[model samples]
Target: MNSAVTTLWEEAGFPEQTVIQRAVSDPLLAGQSVVGIAPTGSGKTLAYGIPVLTRLVPNLGPQLLIIVPAQELAIQIRDVLTPLAHRLNLGVLGLIGSANRQRQIDRLKGKPAVIVATLGRLADLIDERKLRLVDIKTVIVDEFDSFETEDITTIRHMRQDGLLAGANLGLFSATRNDDDIAAFREFWPDLQVFDEIKTDDTRGPVTHYLLDRQFEGKVQFLERLGREKHQRVFVFFNHKHIMQKVAGSLRFTHVPYSLLATDGRQVQRAEALGDFRRGRTNLLLTTDVAARGLDVADVTAVVNFELPNNITTYIHRTGRTGRMGESGTVYNMGNDHDLRDLRHLLGDSVTLVAEKPLVKKREQDDETNDENTPSTDSHDRARTRPASDKMPARKPTAAKSHNKRKQRWRNKKNVGKHW
Candidate 1:
C-alpha cells in the first residue's frame, strides 16, 4: 500500500486491514485478473479500491470502470471512493440510468480517473459513442451475484466489441454458486477465481430470533418495533405490495421510516437514503434488490417482515447488520407455519430462538401493565437469553388439529389465495 493511502486509512479509524483486504490486496495491486468472494460488510470495496487507486495515474481519462447491478450501489461506490481518489489528485464520476445523460456526458469531458457505473447506463453511453474506455486498465464487476441475465449479455457484448478487451477484470460478491462461476468463465476464461473463505472473520456476531407475530400482524409488529429504543433497523418484505402497505401504515402511525423502492424517482430515493443514513429515520423499508451491497453504519437489527424464499436472500438481508465485526440482531417475524418453513430452509447454519416478552419497569407503579415490552431493541437487554439452536416443541393449534383431508379440501377451495 502507498504510505499516503495507508496514512489516510489509519486516519479514517480503520486500525488494520480486514480479512478480505489482506487476502486480495497483493493480487489486485499486481494487476492480476482476480475473483474475490467474501461475506457482505467485509470491506470488499477497499479490498480492491486501495490497490486500484494506488496504481491509477492522475489526469487519466477513466482508468477504472466499476460495474454494479443497481444505480444506488453505483452512487454509493462513487461516494466511498471519491475522498481517496481526491487524495491522489484523481477524480471520480457516477454513470447511472436515473441521472441526466447530457449532464453525465458533460462531466465526462473533465476526464475523471475513476468511473463507477451501472451496466445499463454505461452500455448506452458506450453504444452511443459518448464514453471512451481506451484508458481503462482495470474493470471491476461488483455485486455480480445480484446481476440479471440482461446484465451478463451486455457484459459479453462489451468484451466482444473490444471495449474492455485489454482491461484486467475483478469480480467481487458476497454470495456465489455454480452458475455464477460458469457465467464468468464463459466470458473471462483466464480470470483467477478465489473460493469463498468459510472462516470469514469480518462479519460480526449476530443473534438470530424467531419473533412470533401470530396475534400481532407483521405490520403491527413493525410499528411497535419502531417505537422501541432501536437505532437503525432494516425491515425487509418479499412482496412489493406488502412493503408499500407497511410503509403506508408506518407513515399513518407516525413511525419514522424511509422507503427504498426500485420505481422511486432518483432524487426521492437519494433523499430517503440520506435521511436514513443521518438517523432521521428509525426504520428503512426495502426489498432485497434495492438494499443489496448497501453499507450503512451502526445498524442495530434486521427484521424480516416476510421471510425470503431462499437462504441466499436471507444471508444478504441479515448481512445489512452484523457488519464489520459489529454485534447485531436478526428477527424473523412470522406465524407458526411460516417460522417452521424458515427453520427448515435455514437448517443448522443459523440458530433461531423464540423471543420471550420481558417486563418493563415503570417509573411509577402505574395501573396499566403492558406485557409486550420489546427488550431486544434495548442495547443493554438485547442478549438476555443465551443463544440456542434447538427450537421449542410446537404446541398444536386449533387450525393444525383439524383433519388433513378437510384442510386439503379448504386449500383447494381457496387455491387462488394460496397462489
Candidate 2:
C-alpha cells in the first residue's frame, strides 16, 4: 500500500478497485505523462494519487499541483487527500476560487506539500509570485476535457510557463472527446493511453431512467424515492435558479435535502458538501459545477430535476451515482428535448419502455412551458414533430448530366478499373 493512503479509509467503505485500477499502475505510467479514460467512479484519483504522493516530498514549498474544475471539488479533494497527506505528514494547500483569500494566501506562504485549485486562480497567483511551479514535478489536470473550451487561454498560459519540461502531466476525464484529446498532443506528445474498463468489470454499463414529464413529476418521484431512504442521493439541475427552485420544492414536500448552489460564498458550498458527507442531509441538490470529482459514500441514486444541456454534462451528472462498483439509477426528466439528450448519454444503458409519456397538463404546461417557449401567433398553429426527427439532415442529390450518364455506362463494362 502507498504510505500516503490512510488506514481510516478502510472504514470509509473503499470499494475494491475495478478491473481498471488493477491494470492502471501498469509499467508505462510509473512516472510518465499520461491520459486516462475510464468509466465514472472508477477511482481515477487513486490511480494518479499513488504516483503523485509517492513522488512529491511532504511539508515542502508546494511540490504537487492538482487542478480541478470547481471550488466544491477542491474542498472535496482536500478532504480526501488531506488525511492521506496527514498519514504522510504532508501539508495540502488549496488555491480555489472560494473563501478566505488572505488565509489561502497565507497558506500558500507556508508552501504546503500539495496545491489543488482552479486554473484561473492558480495562474493569477503564479503571476503575482505568490506560488511557484518550478518545484512542481507532478502535475494533474482533472476533468481535462473541461479545460478544453472556456478555459483554453488560461491553461495554455500555464503550460507555456513551464509545464512541458519538468512536470509529469496527467489528464483525466469521463469524456474522451477526441478533439480535446487531440489538442493535448501539443502539450504532451508522449502521452500513453490505457482504458481498463472495457473488459474487466462484470457489472453492466450505466443504467439511465428517463421520466416522460415536464420535470415536475420527476421531482415528486424523487421525493418519493427519498421517502424510501435508500442512502446518499445526488440531485442535479441545469441552472442555479432551477437548482434552488427544486430545493425549495423538495423542502415543501418536507424531505430532508441539502442545496449546493454556485451563487453562494465558496465557504457555504464547502459546508453544504461537508454536511452531506456527515449524514446531516441525505438528499444533495446541486448544479453541474459540483457534479464531478465529488467522492461521497452510499450514493444510491442521482436525480436530474432538469436534464443536462449536453451529453458531457449528462455524463458528469449521472457519474455521481453508480461509482466504485456500486450500481445506482439516474432519473432524468423534462421536455421531449431533454429525453433526447438523455438518450444520447444513455446509449445502451437505459431501457426505453413504450409506456405513454407523462401527459402535459395543459394548464400546468401553460404555466411552465410558457416561460421557456417563445410566443407565436394564434392564427398559425405549431407543427409538432415526433421526438425521433432529430437526425442530421442529408444533402440533396443532384441529377446526373447526360454526359455523366453515358460515362457511367462506359464504367459499367469496366468495373474496378480507373482511368
Candidate 3:
C-alpha cells in the first residue's frame, strides 16, 4: 500500500485490512480484473478503494470509474473516498440522476480523478460527450447483482466499443447465488471470481427476533422502541405503500424518524440520511434503496416492518446493523404465517427466535389500553387497534344495502324498456 493511504487508514483507526480487502488489494494493484464477494458491512468499499487510489495518478482525468445501482450508493461511495482521495491529491465526484445535470457537467470540467456514478447518469454523460472513458483505468461495479440486463448491456456496449478496453473491471457484492455466478460467467468470461463468504468473519453477531405483529401493530411497536434511549434503528419495508403508511403513523407518535424514498430529490434524500446518521432521527424508514453497500455507524438495530420477500433481501436488511464487528439486533415483524414462511425462506442460513410470551402479553395489554383511550384522530385509533381485533370483516352498512337495492331495481326496469 502507498504510504499516504496507509497513514490515512491508521488515522481512520480501522484495525486492519479485512479478509476481502487484503485478498483483492494486490490483484487489483497489479491491474487484474477481479470479482470480490464479501458480506455487507465487511469493508468491501475500502477493499477496492485503497487499491484504486494507490494506482491513481495525481491530476489525472477520471482514472477510476465506480458504477453503482442507486443514487444514494453513488453519493455514499464518493463521500467515503473523497477524504482519502484528497490526501493523495485526487478528487472524487458523484454523478447521480437526482442531481442537476448542468452542475455535474461543470464538475466534470474540473476533471475529477474518481467518479462514483449510477449507470444511467454515467451513460447519459457519455452519450452527450461531456464525459470520456479513455482515461478510465479501473471500472468497478459495486452491488454487482443490482445491475439488470440493460445495465450489463450498456457496460458490454462500452467494452465492445473500446471505450473501456484498457480498464480493469471489478465486481463486488454481498451475496451471489449459483445462478448469479453462472450469469457472471456468461457476461464477463475473463473475470476472476473470489468467494469470501465462508472466510470473511468481519460481521458482528446479529441477534434475530420475530415480532409477530400486523401493519398497525408494527407502527405502534416502533413507538414503543422510540421510548428506549440510544436506539438507532433502520426500518426496512418490502413495499413503498407500507413504508409510507408507517411513516405517516410515526409522524403522529414520539418516534423521531426519517423517510428515505427512491424518487426523492438528492438533497432531500441526503438530508434524511444525514438526520439518521447524526442522531436527529432514531428510525429510518426505507426500502432496499439503503440495503446494499450503505454503511452507517452505530446502527444498534434493524426493524423489518415487513418480512423481506427473499433470503438475499433478508440478509442485506439484517446487515444494516451488526456491521464491522459491532453487535446488533434485528426485529422481524410479521404474523404467524409470515414468521413461518420467513423461517422456511431463510432455511439454515439464519435462526429466528420467537419473541417471548411475557413480552407479547405486555405489548398486547399496552395496545388494548391505548385503543381504549379516546382520540379524535380516526387514523390514530385505527392504527392502535390490536392485530387480532382487526381480523373480522366489516358488515354491510344500511346505506350500502339501500344503494345496492336501488341499483338492482333500476337495472331491472331498464331491461324491458330500452327506448
Candidate 4:
C-alpha cells in the first residue's frame, strides 16, 4: 500500500483490516480481475478503493471507474474515497442522475483520477460523448448483483468496445448464490474468487426475530417500539406504498421519523438520510431502495414491516442492523406465508418469536375449540336421550279415545244416508 493511503486508513481510526479487506488488498493491487464476496459493511469500499488509489496516476484522465447500483451508493463511495484521493493529489468525481447534466459535463473537463457513477447516468454521459472510459484502467462494479441486465450489457459493451480492453474488473457484493457465481464465471472465465461469506461469522451475529403480525399490528408495534426503544431504527418495507403507510402511521403516533424511497426527490432523499445520520431523527422508514449498499452507523435495530420476497433481499435487509461486529436486532413482521418463506430461506438463523400469531392461527384455534364443544343438535339429543341407542317412539294422549268414538258414530250415520 502507498504511504499516503496507509496514513489515511490510520487517520480514519480503523483498528485493522477486516477479513475481506485483508484478503483482497494484495490481489486487487496486483491488477488481477477479482470477485470479492462478503457481507455488507465489511469494508468492501476500502478494500478496492485503497488499491485503486495506490495505483492512480494524477492527471491521467480517469484511470479508475467505479459503478454502483444506486446514486446514493455512488455518492457514498465517492465521499469515502474523495479524501484519500485528495491526500494523494488525485481528483475524484461522483456522477449520478437527477443532477445538473451540464455541471457534470463541466466536472468531466477536469479529468478526475477516479469516477464513481450510477449505471444510468454514466451510460447517458457516455452516449452523449460527455464522458469517455478509454483511459479507465480499473473497472470496479460494487454490488454487482444489483445491476440490471442492461447495466451489465452496457459495461460489457464498454469492454468489448475497447474502452476498457485492458482494464482490471473488480466485482463485489455481500450475497451471491450459485446462479450469481455461474454468471460471474461466464463473465470472467478466469476471475479470481475471494469469498469470505461464513454464514455464522459474516456481519457478526444478528439476532433475528420473526414477528407474526399483519400490517396494522406491525404499524402499532413499530409505534410502540419507537417510543420505548428510542434508538436508531430503520423500518424497511418491500413496497413504497407500505413505506408511505408506515410513515403516516408513525406520524399519526407522533413518532419522529423520516421517509426514504426511490421516487423521492434527490434533495429530500439526501435530507432524510442526513437527518437520520445526524441524529435529528431516530427512525427512518424506507423501501428496498435503501436496503442494499446503505452504510448507516449505529442502526440499533431494523424492523421489516414487509418482509422481502427473496432471500437475497432478506439478507441485505437484516444486514443493515448487525454490522462491523456490532450486535443488533432485526424485527420481522410477516404473515404465515412470509414466515414460511423466511424459514425456508434463512433456515434456523431466524428465531421464531411467537409474538401475535396471524389470523390463520387464531382461526385454527377457534376450529379446534369448536370441535371440542358440543353443537346444538348434539346437545338436544343428549338432553332428550342417549344418541348411541335408538330414539324412543311417541305415545298418544287421552283425547284419541273420544275422537275415535265420535268418528264411529259419524261414519255409521253417513253410511245409512248414502244407501
**Model 3's lDDT to the true fold?**
0.83
Candidate 2 per-residue lDDT, tens place, 1-419, comes to: 45333342342345565555555554223667777777666777776765467566755677778889887777767767777676667788778776666788887877688889987788778778777777877777788877647575566556777643577677777767777666766776777766554664533334566677765777777677666744677888778877777776767666777778767876687778888888777788887776566777667777778776676777666776766567777667667876776677667755744333224478577767788887776333323545575455565456556667879898776654321
Q: Rate the local accuracy (lDDT) of all candidates.
A: 0.82, 0.69, 0.83, 0.80
How many Å off is the CA of 324 in candidate 3? 2.5
User: Per-residue lDDT of 26-78 in model 1, one digit per residue for the tens?
Assistant: 78888888888888888888888888887889886899999998888998999
Which one wins by TM-score: 3 or 4?
Answer: 3
lDDT (0-100) at residue 39 of candidate 4?
Answer: 84
Give the TM-score (vs. native) of candidate 2.
0.75
Residue runs of model 4 more than 4 Å from their true location after superposition? 178-187, 199-202, 349-352, 355-419
TM-scores, all models, native as reference? 0.83, 0.75, 0.83, 0.81
Candidate 4, poorest ten consecutive residues by summed lDDT: 351-360
TM-score of structure candidate 3: 0.83
The Cα RMSD of model 1 versus the native structure comes to 13.7
Q: Model 1 reaches what TM-score against the true structure?
A: 0.83
Local lDDT at 126 for model 3: 95
Cα error, residue 116 of model 2, in Å, equals: 0.5
Q: Quote the lDDT for 24 in model 1.
A: 79
Total clashing pairs for each candidate: 0, 0, 0, 0
